[model samples]
Target: MGKSPDIIKDTSETLKPVSGRGITVMQGWYDKNIKACHVTLWDLGETDDNFSDDDAEGVTLSVQVTIFSQEDEVELAREIKSLMKADGFSFEGRNGDDSEPEDGIYMKAQRFSKFYESEE
Candidate 1:
Protein backbone atom coordinates (compact mmCIF):
# COMPACT_ATOMS: atom_id res chain seq x y z
CA MET A 1 0.00 0.00 0.00
CA GLY A 2 1.11 3.49 -0.75
CA LYS A 3 1.70 6.21 1.82
CA SER A 4 -0.76 9.06 2.28
CA PRO A 5 0.99 11.73 0.23
CA ASP A 6 1.86 9.46 -2.64
CA ILE A 7 -1.65 8.09 -2.88
CA ILE A 8 -3.28 11.50 -2.79
CA LYS A 9 -0.96 12.90 -5.45
CA ASP A 10 -1.67 9.98 -7.74
CA THR A 11 -5.40 10.38 -7.26
CA SER A 12 -5.27 14.12 -7.79
CA GLU A 13 -3.70 13.64 -11.19
CA THR A 14 -6.61 11.49 -12.19
CA LEU A 15 -9.02 14.38 -11.79
CA LYS A 16 -9.70 16.33 -14.98
CA PRO A 17 -10.18 20.06 -15.58
CA VAL A 18 -8.67 21.00 -12.24
CA SER A 19 -7.68 24.67 -12.48
CA GLY A 20 -5.13 24.41 -9.73
CA ARG A 21 -1.54 25.23 -10.39
CA GLY A 22 -0.45 21.73 -9.36
CA ILE A 23 -0.63 19.09 -6.66
CA THR A 24 2.41 18.56 -4.54
CA VAL A 25 3.51 17.65 -1.04
CA MET A 26 3.02 20.46 1.38
CA GLN A 27 6.16 22.26 2.31
CA GLY A 28 6.36 25.01 4.92
CA TRP A 29 5.29 28.36 3.42
CA TYR A 30 5.72 27.08 -0.12
CA ASP A 31 2.27 28.21 -1.20
CA LYS A 32 3.45 31.78 -0.84
CA ASN A 33 5.41 31.36 -4.04
CA ILE A 34 2.51 30.06 -6.11
CA LYS A 35 -0.19 32.44 -7.36
CA ALA A 36 -2.94 30.07 -8.36
CA CYS A 37 -5.22 27.44 -7.02
CA HIS A 38 -2.66 25.04 -5.51
CA VAL A 39 -3.38 21.93 -3.52
CA THR A 40 -0.95 20.71 -0.88
CA LEU A 41 -0.86 17.20 0.53
CA TRP A 42 0.33 15.86 3.89
CA ASP A 43 0.03 12.65 5.85
CA LEU A 44 -1.81 12.79 9.13
CA GLY A 45 -1.11 9.16 10.13
CA GLU A 46 -1.85 5.48 9.44
CA THR A 47 -3.93 2.81 11.09
CA ASP A 48 -2.51 0.37 13.60
CA ASP A 49 -1.82 -3.28 12.68
CA ASN A 50 -1.82 -2.41 9.02
CA PHE A 51 -0.04 -5.61 8.11
CA SER A 52 -2.16 -8.74 7.99
CA ASP A 53 0.25 -11.32 6.52
CA ASP A 54 3.34 -11.71 4.39
CA ASP A 55 1.26 -11.64 1.24
CA ALA A 56 -1.39 -9.22 2.43
CA GLU A 57 -0.91 -5.71 3.74
CA GLY A 58 -3.34 -2.87 4.36
CA VAL A 59 -3.19 0.70 5.55
CA THR A 60 -5.76 3.33 6.44
CA LEU A 61 -4.14 6.64 5.69
CA SER A 62 -5.24 10.05 6.82
CA VAL A 63 -4.46 12.61 4.15
CA GLN A 64 -4.48 16.32 4.84
CA VAL A 65 -5.43 18.56 1.91
CA THR A 66 -4.97 22.29 1.88
CA ILE A 67 -6.33 24.57 -0.81
CA PHE A 68 -4.53 27.81 -1.53
CA SER A 69 -6.47 30.44 -3.39
CA GLN A 70 -7.01 34.15 -3.45
CA GLU A 71 -10.72 33.65 -3.91
CA ASP A 72 -13.25 31.23 -2.48
CA GLU A 73 -12.19 27.58 -2.56
CA VAL A 74 -15.63 26.04 -2.14
CA GLU A 75 -16.11 24.90 -5.75
CA LEU A 76 -12.58 23.57 -5.96
CA ALA A 77 -13.01 21.78 -2.66
CA ARG A 78 -16.24 20.18 -3.81
CA GLU A 79 -14.68 18.97 -7.03
CA ILE A 80 -11.80 17.49 -5.12
CA LYS A 81 -14.15 15.75 -2.70
CA SER A 82 -16.21 14.27 -5.49
CA LEU A 83 -13.21 13.09 -7.44
CA MET A 84 -11.70 11.49 -4.33
CA LYS A 85 -14.91 9.64 -3.50
CA ALA A 86 -15.35 8.49 -7.07
CA ASP A 87 -11.85 7.07 -6.91
CA GLY A 88 -12.75 5.03 -3.78
CA PHE A 89 -11.10 7.24 -1.18
CA SER A 90 -13.13 7.61 1.99
CA PHE A 91 -14.12 11.00 3.26
CA GLU A 92 -13.31 10.93 6.95
CA GLY A 93 -14.08 14.59 7.64
CA ARG A 94 -12.59 18.05 7.62
CA ASN A 95 -11.11 20.33 10.23
CA GLY A 96 -13.81 22.34 11.98
CA ASP A 97 -11.43 25.25 12.22
CA ASP A 98 -9.64 27.01 9.36
CA SER A 99 -6.26 28.61 9.12
CA GLU A 100 -5.77 32.34 8.71
CA PRO A 101 -4.72 33.59 5.32
CA GLU A 102 -1.16 34.59 4.66
CA ASP A 103 -0.32 37.39 2.19
CA GLY A 104 -3.79 37.40 0.66
CA ILE A 105 -3.70 33.65 0.25
CA TYR A 106 -6.65 31.91 1.83
CA MET A 107 -6.46 28.29 2.90
CA LYS A 108 -8.87 25.50 3.78
CA ALA A 109 -7.80 22.24 5.38
CA GLN A 110 -9.62 18.98 4.78
CA ARG A 111 -8.84 15.45 5.91
CA PHE A 112 -9.62 12.32 3.94
CA SER A 113 -9.15 8.67 4.84
CA LYS A 114 -8.50 5.78 2.50
CA PHE A 115 -7.78 2.09 2.99
CA TYR A 116 -5.51 0.20 0.60
CA GLU A 117 -4.34 -3.38 0.38
CA SER A 118 -1.75 -5.27 -1.63
CA GLU A 119 -1.18 -8.96 -2.03
CA GLU A 120 2.17 -10.38 -2.91
Candidate 2:
Protein backbone atom coordinates (compact mmCIF):
# COMPACT_ATOMS: atom_id res chain seq x y z
CA MET A 1 0.00 0.00 0.00
CA GLY A 2 1.10 3.60 -0.60
CA LYS A 3 0.12 6.84 1.11
CA SER A 4 -3.41 6.96 2.45
CA PRO A 5 -4.21 9.66 -0.15
CA ASP A 6 -6.03 11.95 2.26
CA ILE A 7 -5.40 15.53 1.16
CA ILE A 8 -6.05 18.74 3.11
CA LYS A 9 -4.91 21.98 1.52
CA ASP A 10 -3.64 24.64 3.90
CA THR A 11 -0.65 26.26 2.27
CA SER A 12 0.86 25.89 -1.20
CA GLU A 13 2.95 23.08 0.32
CA THR A 14 -0.04 20.78 0.60
CA LEU A 15 -0.95 21.16 -3.06
CA LYS A 16 2.45 20.84 -4.73
CA PRO A 17 3.38 17.71 -6.69
CA VAL A 18 6.23 15.48 -5.74
CA SER A 19 7.78 15.41 -9.18
CA GLY A 20 8.46 18.52 -11.26
CA ARG A 21 5.62 17.95 -13.63
CA GLY A 22 2.64 20.23 -13.03
CA ILE A 23 -0.43 20.50 -10.89
CA THR A 24 -3.51 19.85 -12.97
CA VAL A 25 -6.39 22.10 -12.02
CA MET A 26 -9.94 22.01 -13.24
CA GLN A 27 -11.17 25.56 -12.99
CA GLY A 28 -13.50 28.16 -14.43
CA TRP A 29 -14.41 31.75 -14.04
CA TYR A 30 -17.67 33.02 -12.63
CA ASP A 31 -18.79 36.61 -12.64
CA LYS A 32 -21.50 37.80 -10.31
CA ASN A 33 -22.08 41.55 -10.02
CA ILE A 34 -18.76 43.24 -9.38
CA LYS A 35 -16.88 40.16 -8.23
CA ALA A 36 -15.26 37.67 -10.58
CA CYS A 37 -14.46 34.40 -8.94
CA HIS A 38 -12.09 31.74 -10.20
CA VAL A 39 -12.62 28.14 -9.23
CA THR A 40 -9.67 25.76 -9.12
CA LEU A 41 -9.37 22.15 -8.07
CA TRP A 42 -6.30 20.02 -7.33
CA ASP A 43 -6.25 16.28 -6.87
CA LEU A 44 -4.35 13.07 -7.54
CA GLY A 45 -3.63 11.67 -10.97
CA GLU A 46 -3.85 7.90 -11.03
CA THR A 47 -2.37 5.54 -13.64
CA ASP A 48 -4.02 2.16 -13.55
CA ASP A 49 -2.55 -0.54 -15.77
CA ASN A 50 -5.79 -2.45 -15.47
CA PHE A 51 -7.33 0.28 -17.54
CA SER A 52 -7.05 -0.31 -21.27
CA ASP A 53 -8.71 1.08 -24.37
CA ASP A 54 -10.51 -2.25 -24.75
CA ASP A 55 -13.07 -0.92 -22.23
CA ALA A 56 -13.83 -4.53 -21.22
CA GLU A 57 -11.84 -5.07 -18.05
CA GLY A 58 -9.96 -1.84 -17.48
CA VAL A 59 -9.75 0.74 -14.70
CA THR A 60 -7.89 4.03 -15.13
CA LEU A 61 -7.52 7.07 -12.89
CA SER A 62 -9.18 10.37 -13.72
CA VAL A 63 -11.00 13.40 -12.34
CA GLN A 64 -14.49 14.88 -12.49
CA VAL A 65 -15.64 18.51 -12.57
CA THR A 66 -19.04 19.78 -11.48
CA ILE A 67 -20.03 23.38 -10.92
CA PHE A 68 -21.16 23.96 -7.38
CA SER A 69 -21.65 27.66 -7.34
CA GLN A 70 -22.06 30.74 -9.50
CA GLU A 71 -22.84 33.26 -6.87
CA ASP A 72 -20.38 34.12 -4.14
CA GLU A 73 -16.71 33.18 -3.92
CA VAL A 74 -17.35 31.83 -0.48
CA GLU A 75 -20.09 29.61 -1.77
CA LEU A 76 -18.02 28.61 -4.79
CA ALA A 77 -15.06 27.77 -2.63
CA ARG A 78 -17.32 25.86 -0.33
CA GLU A 79 -18.73 23.87 -3.20
CA ILE A 80 -15.30 23.19 -4.65
CA LYS A 81 -14.11 22.07 -1.25
CA SER A 82 -17.16 19.90 -0.93
CA LEU A 83 -16.33 18.28 -4.25
CA MET A 84 -12.84 17.74 -2.98
CA LYS A 85 -14.53 15.50 -0.45
CA ALA A 86 -16.10 13.40 -3.24
CA ASP A 87 -19.66 13.55 -1.97
CA GLY A 88 -21.87 13.35 -5.05
CA PHE A 89 -18.95 11.72 -6.84
CA SER A 90 -19.02 7.97 -6.60
CA PHE A 91 -16.26 5.65 -7.79
CA GLU A 92 -18.20 2.72 -9.15
CA GLY A 93 -16.07 2.47 -12.36
CA ARG A 94 -15.27 4.29 -15.60
CA ASN A 95 -17.36 6.04 -18.25
CA GLY A 96 -17.63 3.08 -20.63
CA ASP A 97 -16.96 0.46 -18.02
CA ASP A 98 -20.22 -1.28 -18.87
CA SER A 99 -19.39 -1.49 -22.60
CA GLU A 100 -16.32 -1.59 -24.80
CA PRO A 101 -15.17 1.64 -26.44
CA GLU A 102 -12.41 0.21 -28.65
CA ASP A 103 -9.89 1.40 -26.09
CA GLY A 104 -8.46 -0.38 -23.08
CA ILE A 105 -7.83 2.63 -20.88
CA TYR A 106 -10.06 4.09 -18.18
CA MET A 107 -9.72 6.84 -15.66
CA LYS A 108 -11.13 7.03 -12.14
CA ALA A 109 -11.33 9.83 -9.61
CA GLN A 110 -8.94 9.48 -6.70
CA ARG A 111 -7.48 11.67 -3.95
CA PHE A 112 -3.83 12.27 -3.05
CA SER A 113 -2.34 13.22 0.30
CA LYS A 114 1.01 14.86 -0.34
CA PHE A 115 2.71 17.19 -2.84
CA TYR A 116 5.96 19.13 -3.18
CA GLU A 117 6.28 22.86 -3.87
CA SER A 118 9.35 24.47 -5.36
CA GLU A 119 11.16 27.09 -3.28
CA GLU A 120 11.29 29.67 -5.98
Candidate 3:
Protein backbone atom coordinates (compact mmCIF):
# COMPACT_ATOMS: atom_id res chain seq x y z
CA MET A 1 0.00 0.00 0.00
CA GLY A 2 1.16 3.56 -0.73
CA LYS A 3 0.31 7.00 0.59
CA SER A 4 -1.45 8.64 -2.32
CA PRO A 5 -1.36 9.18 -6.06
CA ASP A 6 -1.02 12.96 -5.84
CA ILE A 7 2.36 12.76 -4.20
CA ILE A 8 3.80 10.89 -7.12
CA LYS A 9 3.32 13.58 -9.74
CA ASP A 10 5.77 16.33 -8.91
CA THR A 11 9.05 14.96 -10.23
CA SER A 12 10.94 15.71 -13.42
CA GLU A 13 9.48 15.25 -16.87
CA THR A 14 13.04 14.80 -18.10
CA LEU A 15 13.05 11.15 -19.04
CA LYS A 16 16.10 11.80 -21.15
CA PRO A 17 17.65 8.60 -22.40
CA VAL A 18 20.99 8.19 -20.68
CA SER A 19 23.59 6.22 -22.62
CA GLY A 20 27.23 5.65 -21.74
CA ARG A 21 29.67 3.11 -20.34
CA GLY A 22 29.40 1.76 -16.79
CA ILE A 23 25.82 2.96 -16.27
CA THR A 24 23.35 0.62 -14.56
CA VAL A 25 19.69 0.86 -13.69
CA MET A 26 19.04 -0.31 -10.16
CA GLN A 27 15.34 0.45 -9.69
CA GLY A 28 12.28 2.01 -11.33
CA TRP A 29 8.74 2.80 -10.12
CA TYR A 30 5.86 5.30 -10.18
CA ASP A 31 4.57 7.12 -7.13
CA LYS A 32 1.03 8.33 -6.75
CA ASN A 33 1.56 10.69 -3.86
CA ILE A 34 3.91 13.69 -3.91
CA LYS A 35 3.58 13.44 -7.66
CA ALA A 36 7.16 12.34 -8.20
CA CYS A 37 9.36 9.30 -8.85
CA HIS A 38 12.86 8.32 -7.86
CA VAL A 39 14.80 6.74 -10.68
CA THR A 40 17.92 5.20 -9.12
CA LEU A 41 20.50 4.69 -11.85
CA TRP A 42 24.18 3.95 -11.45
CA ASP A 43 27.36 3.93 -13.53
CA LEU A 44 29.56 0.90 -13.35
CA GLY A 45 32.61 -0.23 -15.33
CA GLU A 46 32.62 -0.93 -19.04
CA THR A 47 33.69 -3.79 -21.33
CA ASP A 48 34.44 -4.28 -24.98
CA ASP A 49 31.69 -5.66 -27.21
CA ASN A 50 33.89 -8.63 -28.14
CA PHE A 51 34.19 -9.64 -24.49
CA SER A 52 30.74 -8.59 -23.23
CA ASP A 53 28.81 -9.78 -26.27
CA ASP A 54 25.93 -7.68 -25.05
CA ASP A 55 23.63 -5.50 -27.11
CA ALA A 56 25.27 -2.12 -26.59
CA GLU A 57 28.99 -1.64 -26.38
CA GLY A 58 31.37 0.82 -24.66
CA VAL A 59 28.87 2.80 -22.53
CA THR A 60 25.81 1.24 -20.80
CA LEU A 61 22.86 2.64 -18.88
CA SER A 62 20.80 1.38 -15.93
CA VAL A 63 18.45 3.02 -13.41
CA GLN A 64 16.10 2.46 -10.47
CA VAL A 65 12.72 4.14 -9.94
CA THR A 66 10.87 4.60 -6.65
CA ILE A 67 7.60 6.24 -5.73
CA PHE A 68 6.44 7.16 -2.27
CA SER A 69 3.31 6.14 -0.32
CA GLN A 70 0.16 5.31 -2.26
CA GLU A 71 -3.04 3.33 -1.88
CA ASP A 72 -1.51 0.19 -3.31
CA GLU A 73 2.17 -0.17 -3.93
CA VAL A 74 1.74 -3.55 -5.58
CA GLU A 75 -0.96 -2.33 -7.94
CA LEU A 76 0.99 0.80 -8.81
CA ALA A 77 4.13 -1.23 -9.34
CA ARG A 78 2.19 -3.54 -11.62
CA GLU A 79 1.12 -0.58 -13.70
CA ILE A 80 4.66 0.69 -14.09
CA LYS A 81 5.86 -2.79 -14.97
CA SER A 82 3.29 -3.03 -17.70
CA LEU A 83 4.38 0.25 -19.32
CA MET A 84 8.04 -0.75 -19.45
CA LYS A 85 6.82 -3.99 -20.97
CA ALA A 86 5.61 -1.97 -23.91
CA ASP A 87 7.97 -1.07 -26.76
CA GLY A 88 6.85 2.41 -27.75
CA PHE A 89 6.90 4.72 -24.77
CA SER A 90 8.45 7.58 -26.68
CA PHE A 91 9.40 8.11 -30.31
CA GLU A 92 11.33 5.04 -31.39
CA GLY A 93 14.71 5.32 -33.13
CA ARG A 94 14.56 9.02 -32.35
CA ASN A 95 18.03 8.90 -30.92
CA GLY A 96 20.59 6.56 -29.44
CA ASP A 97 17.78 4.74 -27.66
CA ASP A 98 16.53 1.57 -29.30
CA SER A 99 13.16 1.43 -30.90
CA GLU A 100 10.36 -0.96 -30.02
CA PRO A 101 10.67 -4.25 -31.86
CA GLU A 102 8.11 -5.58 -34.26
CA ASP A 103 6.88 -7.93 -31.54
CA GLY A 104 3.60 -7.38 -29.68
CA ILE A 105 3.39 -4.90 -26.85
CA TYR A 106 1.37 -4.04 -23.76
CA MET A 107 0.71 -0.93 -21.61
CA LYS A 108 1.54 -1.15 -17.90
CA ALA A 109 1.40 2.44 -16.67
CA GLN A 110 -1.87 3.73 -15.30
CA ARG A 111 -3.14 7.26 -16.14
CA PHE A 112 -1.28 8.66 -13.17
CA SER A 113 0.14 12.16 -13.55
CA LYS A 114 3.65 12.65 -12.20
CA PHE A 115 2.85 16.28 -11.49
CA TYR A 116 0.10 18.60 -10.39
CA GLU A 117 -1.35 21.67 -12.08
CA SER A 118 -1.98 24.67 -9.95
CA GLU A 119 -5.54 25.87 -9.49
CA GLU A 120 -5.92 28.49 -12.19
Best by TM-score: 1
lDDT of 3 by residue, 1-120 (tens): 233222212112222231122222223443223232233321222222322344332221222343233222445445444453342222111112112423222112222222212221
Clashing pairs for model 1 are: none
- Each prediction's TM-score versus the true structure: 0.69, 0.23, 0.29
Model 1, 21-101: lDDT tens digits are 444434333456777667777767777435455443666667777777787678778887887788778887776534465
Candidate 3 to truth, TM? 0.29
- TM-score order of candidates, top first: 1, 3, 2
Worst 10 residues of 1 by lDDT: 21-30
- What candidate 2 gets wrong by more than 4 Å, as runs, is 1-35, 41-43, 49-56, 60-74, 81-120
CA RMSD of all predictions: 4.2, 16.1, 17.9
Error of 3 at 10 (Å): 17
lDDT of 2 at 8: 27
